[model samples]
Target: MDGHPLRLALDLLKGTLALTVHKIRYGLASRLWHGTNLVTEQMSRHTQQVRLLRAGEVLGSLDVSTVRDEIGSRRGTVSFNGCLHQLFSGQPLTRQEKALVLAQLVASFSLTTSYDFADSPLLDGDDRLLMREVLYGAGFAAREMRTFIYQSRQDGQDTTADIESKSTREQTRSATRKLEVVDVSLDEFIRFHDANLAQKHNYRRWDIDAAFVADALALGKARILAARGRSADGLTPQGIQAAMIYTWDDISLKLYRISYDTAKTANPHANKVLIARGMQMAHDLGLLLDTDCAPPGAAILYERFGFPERVRTHYVRATLLSKFAAFIRRDFPSLDRRLRPWVIRAVTRVNRSAA
Candidate 1:
């Protein structure tokens, strides 16, 4: 009531102009979001730098001489045969066996580790060479040791099996071959994948959802292997104890999912057995995975089957607007916090004016 009419109109005009400016800035920011990708590369480079620094520290402390000497001696490889025997025998590998398995896994890991963080510029030439020497030595030793066992069997040499009786050999064979890997229909695979694999953090992160699985099945791009246990009733269908899902992408057979139940009815060694079956299926179909973004467990399984390790590269592209928003939230916290309320009030004022 005390305000001059002209002054009041000028104030209203100022408020409208401020609102218009805010809207224009928001629109510009959004456009900027889609227009930029440099931030993504910068973030990736920083991540690689941190990881490579840690890797360099670990490799620096490694004893390359011992690894080399171990590889030269056939004793380590011969001992690893017992570990493989236990795996195929449906027995839980002992602590020693697990250690041996880790050693074997290092072979595949070493072949790719040096190149994995090639984007990082932090690793000096000498540091990279040290990493290569240690990794390569461990890889060589593992391959030599593991190869010795399998090669012994192929050569008809007296293996760990020689100590066991004929009946024991038959039992081991039966147990290892107990799982039947059969392909299932799309609907059947979906039901199994949804229940067993969908919600798993690793699979979910990779976008292996129902939609992806469905497309894989419908397009005949997948080989869904369901491990059927022995049927209790002669007429009843064999129950599914475990499943492995693989989708063929061009030249590579990508492992999508693999999980097994540990119930009394399920096989104790379903994990290794399913992996073996999956590898056999791959062989039958004439496929090999050049690059598989699977968990370490699955990677170990494939490496055990003599699959070569492949290097992979990932790209990240982010918009300018996203970077701007992140910057605003980080550097101008108060402004960021007030932004939503400002927008709400501006919209309300416009609505009131229209009414």
Candidate 2:
């Protein structure tokens, strides 16, 4: 008999024993306290890693990486680390832990990390407090507060029906051709985004890339909606004029991006039709429709289409230098809050200039 066989058998036995012990402990802890701390602490200790913890259990982990397209730009981001809900459990980190996570992120990636936080009633109150304190302590400043909205499948169906009826009337009166909607491949979606939407706005920081869409598509996690139009010669296809990229969860289908041509002569009703179509698709799937983060004006547009404000989210960002300084400097606790208005104005100016 080979000694390797015995060794492998022993290793398998050890692994099985460890897993059994883990499950027993988790079960006991869960029964004892319906809360997560005990189990979460054990999980953190076992992994010896920093992770998003909730109810004392590890909900998820974060990963930081350099933006491939921004390789030379010295920009890095905390890419989508699992689903948004899993990572942001509303659990706040202790100051020391927050400092450690941020320091490690900056040192490892050599760039600041940014993420969005959406408020939910499900989160623990202390968790929300920790979120604010840690981000503020880490010198992470809040960006424009965007409204997140959703509509039920039934409401979506009703809205889509009304929009379709109106679109038909408008098409007949204006003699404007309605763009045909179709499902597009990842490559086609990327081309439309790059040509029509990428350069039109300074959305590099928030825009979804091809790799993300490709991975989602490969995993059967998303749907692509594209609008095909006629070319100037009225013969060849004009490629994608409007597109809506969306994904789903147990409850809702969320629009990730919506792009359309902004030329003056372009059909004014194109976006409305595309949006109505997206709603209809979500309805057919028996899921609520969610519009991603939108500015106040855009929120108004979503409301018109039957999506009402479901939640609000803020994009929080911090620089490595500022985060470090926050750990060292303890004076003027109110300074950041007091200067927030001015900072917002300054950032708005910079963004406008860049655009």
How well does each candidate superpose onto the true structure, as a TM-score?
Answer: 0.38, 0.53
- Give the alpha carbon lDDT tens digit for every residue of 274-310 in model 1: 5555444445555543223445765554454444444
Q: lDDT of candidate 2 vs native? A: 0.48
Please give the CA lDDT of all the candidate structures.
Answer: 0.38, 0.48
lDDT of 2 by residue, 210-250 (tens): 54455456556578887766567767766566788886544
Where is model 2 more than 4 Å wrong at Cα? Answer: 1-69, 72-83, 86-130, 133-139, 153-177, 197-208, 230-238, 318-355
> Which parts of model 1 are misplaced by more than 4 Å?
1-173, 193-208, 316-355
Worst 10-residue stretch by lDDT in candidate 1? Answer: 59-68
Q: Where is model 2 poorest over a 10-residue stretch in terms of lDDT?
A: 39-48
- Name the lDDT value of residue 11 in candidate 2: 42
Winning model by lDDT: 2
Q: Tell me how far the alpha carbon of residue 94 in candidate 2 is from the true structure, in angstroms, after superposition.
A: 16
- Candidate 1, residue 195: CA error in Å? 4.1
